[model samples]
Target chain A: MNKKIKTYYLLTAFTIFMFGFSYMLVPIYEVFCEITGLNGKTGSINSTLVIEKPVERFVRVQFTSNVINSAPFKFSPGKKEMVIQPGKIYTTFYTLTNQSNQPLLATANPSITPGKYAEYFKKIECFCFTHQQINANETKELAVQFIVDKKLPSEATSLVLAYTMFDITKQLGYKLEK
Target chain B: MNTDADHLHEDHKTGIMRWITTTNHKDIGTLYLFLSLTMFFVGGAMALIIRAELFQPGLQLVNPDFFNQMTTMHALIMIFGALMPALVGLANWQIPLMIGAPDMALPRLNNWSFWILPFALGMLGSTLFFEGGAPAAGWTLYPPLVLQGGDALPYAIFSIHLLGLSSILGAINIIATILNMRAPGMTLMKMPMFVWTWLITAFLLIAVMPVLAGAVTMLLTDRFFGTSFFTASGGGDPVMFQHIFWFFGHPEVYILILPAFGVISTIIPTFSRKKLFGYDSMVYATASIALLSFIVWAHHMFTVGMPLAGEIFFMMTTMLIAVPTGVKVFNWIATMWKGSMTFETPMLFSLAFIVLFTIGGFSGLMMAITPVDFQYHDTYFIVAHFHYVLVPGSVFAVIAAVYFWLPKWTGKMYDETLGKTHFWLTTIFVNITFFPQHFVGLAGMPRRIPDYAVQFTDFNAISTIGSFGFGIAQILFLYILYKTLKQDVTADNKVWEGAEGLEWTLPSPPPYHSFEEPPKVE
Candidate 1:
């Protein structure tokens, strides 16, 4: 009888430990994700590069775009969509634009889906890659230059680069979209 | 002290007033069973309506809102009104007898628990006629959406609070009775596994009911009091609600199934004509499963952007559960191996339960794989998984329990022919209703939608037809129950040759107040 009671108590202690452990683990994991970016950052993907190459071999493509928000936006084109041979790097003209009504108040939120490719794509000097703001109706353009890796697969064609323009003013509930 | 003849003519008149005001275990058990049966039919009818709506997918029978209400009400009714109450009814009837006590430890509390159910379910069911409608949010009552539901929300929440309170109190009563009121010679280890399982289940209820109460309270406060506890705009996370809900929710699943485990344990031994193999191991396994239940909450939330570490931890823990669960399945099969088995209706249901529940368990394991669950979550696969466990696993055990005990309770034999008919109809139709759901879910059909796209229509039609057939089949159970109550038939004191228990020591249809002096346990 005493043994039964002892076993019961031991089981009770075990159950309590498990319950507490379950509650603690969730927040701990959230912290890990925050520190490691192990699952890739949420809402953190922002650059759109359109490459247009009319002819094959080495071709030059000009990039153009309008920026309506406050952050500086830049685009680089590799070989254009029409002509790009496998294992070749073509000089592509890069364009940068900035349209902001005021200094940016909100930080850039970047995210990626199908979360398998975070290592392959690296971002630098991006308007959304970091926090920056342009003055109201301020339009500025810059060039981004890059070469498509010769080792890049032929099947890696026509990638979609998307940039969502978030309004910091509207986030604060004021109409700033001109 | 007394001879058999003197005992036979002894004044058995416990007056009408005794029944009305009684705290007697047997009386309370009778009331609970009858009430649950009534609720079962009511809930079953609601299911028929849902099936009728999905009969051909284009709103054949009811509007979308009404269809939602039917689905919601059906789940609410089955989980609370029917299955839980029925198990409690069995507990009321058997716990004392099995333990050699005269009644529950806290008898008044038992009555209160039983009586509160009707009012709670009444409040819940009456919401169908309310200005908005019955709770359309699925039984999980996930917020942000449930908050958008109007006046009926409070009624539903109030009903849930009442139900949870009743369950908590019932658990307390069971715990007290098992811990404090066993016969002098009945030690903890010697206590029936049914009693032991319920003891653990009661502990679970006491621990989690408050959490559920707190969760629903937060929901109410958020909706009415402008609390931002779950609002994304006010720095509260919507995902936090899932965390809290599943915290209480996972254990709630065990609360439904543990008693069924008890029932299966009881039936398997009786029919197999053998002592339950590894009784101590069975007890340990039940405890392990209950302990593991707490950590497994996150398995249900793999798609909610849970961190990879959290996902792996939950996945591994959830899978670890199958070890003990597999032990139980193996134990049951071994118990039955080469034993002279009979095909009585109760035994038949129990046999079916062993096979079907294992199938459910495998699917559950399949769902626990985090990557695979990403495809299965919130889809028909999930729907199929639970229904498999719930319908055959829990519901079938409840039926088997009823059949096993009916003769002992009523002192009359149920028509075996009719019972077998009911079993076959239920078994066939239940599979038909839920099996195709797997294919549809794999084909990417999400659950809780009132309508579906045309391509998925065929499987939906087959499932809906099965649902209707299963719904109508339950009327046979009702008829059998009615016939047994009205007819006269004799049952022997030892109801079955293989049956073993203190309850079997008494005359069939035990006296209104049994073991006024507690019986000695061997």
Candidate 2:
């Protein structure tokens, strides 16, 4: 009987451990992404990898921008495309207009087409990494400074950097109403 | 120690109150079975509604959104509510009796596990009344889309948590009872296949159910607590949700079917008048299948865009599962190879389970070829694959078990003619309903859509008619069960001529506390 009770306790403890392991997968998944670069999740550039010799090759980078339907904003790329030499820095901007009557808090999410280029597409400075607040009917320009790594795979000739802007204000507005 | 017959009068109550308050394993088992049967009808109704809408294609019975809700709710109720609970119900009744134990190791916990289900199901069923209707994101509950759903999301999450808790507790009790409460000298290897299958299944429940709990908890936090666990915009990956979900979801498929293996293992041998051909190998095969279940989860996500290496690894592992599964099937066939055979409802169901489940298995193999899955993913072919496994594989086995054991359970004979009729109708209609799905899927009709291209019209109509036929057959099943319960043509201890097991040693309609004094096994 005592043994049975002890086994029960042990099994219960194992269940609790599994509960912890479920949460542990969050960090585990992040680490796995960092290692495999799966899902186009990018890693921050450190000076250590920048020591590679620059290549003379040029890659055409096109910019695409759009706003979600529920988010009352107009967004477009300042320039449609730019040709940059591999291992060189390039700068671009996107124009945003708040079409709503109230102030809007917007955040931009970035994705690179073909996915393989996401790891090599390094952002030195970008509005996507920060939050922007625009007054009612206000227009604003956001800058994105980036570098194409020398290690960008040889088969990658072109890339599309797409940014989708979400209005957090309206998202939170529904919450406040609730 | 009192013999079972001597203790027949031991304060056993007979009424609704007895069911509500009783801690006896048998009472709890009965509760679980009745609840599961009720849910089977409810889920089946939802399936019929889905078929009715999809019958002629373009928005026939329901709009697209409500149609999505029906598909989603139908899966949830049938998998969690009907099939799982029924297996657990069978385990509760059979395990103790088969092992020569008086009752489960933890009776009160057993009662608690059974009782939590009704409330969980109530919470789940009530989601249909919510403003957005019940969880239109399908049972996968993938985020971003799922997050857009209204009040039903939270209710669905809560119900899942309750259901997971119930299954976990039930698993713990089964483990404890099997490990600690076995009759002296029965020995681990000597234990019956049903007990062995359930023993492994309990471990599976313990392992993966918590992962499901974890996944749903993350979803809950993401929805209500402003956490970004699955919000890709906030440094979280939405695909990670699929990874975690199928981690639980893959094994969940096995949890639904392994008991069916046990049921078939038992029935095949009895009808063949032989001991199971490869008893030891069957045990090893079950363990192998359980072990392989963990590594092969990503097969379900083949179309989710995994890396080539990850795809190859998952594809290989998924294909590897067929080996042990084939072992189980081969052993069943070998058991019935040359022995004297009979075709009762249970035996017929087992025979069909082997052939049809193999077809499902072959389709699963086709999907395992990573490139092939690209075409089959999210199509009716995928739907046909799982339904074949689940309906003929798991659900058929459950019905077979009930029919096989009904005489013992009720101490009366079910009408043989009616039983065989139910069996034949179910077999034919089940095939009719699901087989055409393969053609429609290969023709590229995506699932969960209420409206479809006119090209899919013919097959969809045939499938719907088949579903209605299958639905009517179950009503006959319900009537058969009812008639058996109401009448009392006393059954003998060994209900079948060739039956052999600890369970067959007991009186028909086993005493309220079976094996009050544990039987000594040779």
Q: Judged by lDDT, which candidate is best?
A: 2
Q: Write the per-residue lDDT of candidate 2 for residues A1-178, one digit (tens) a residue.
A: 4766777888898888888888898899888776666666554776654545667788999999877655788999999999988776678899999987887778888878767668888888888835578878989999998887888889999988989887766444443221
True contacts kept of 1: 0.00
Candidate 2 docking category? medium
The sequence of per-residue lDDT tens digits that candidate 1 reaches over residues B351-391 is 89988998899999999999988899999889899999999
Q: Provide the global lDDT of candidate 2 against the true structure.
A: 0.89
Candidate 1 lDDT score at position B214: 66
Give candidates' CA RMSD values in order. 9.2, 2.4
Using TM-score as the measure, the top candidate is: 2
iRMS, all models: 7.6, 1.5
Residue B7 displacement (Å), model 2 = 8.8
Q: Give the CA lDDT, 0 to 100, for residue B202 in model 2.
A: 93
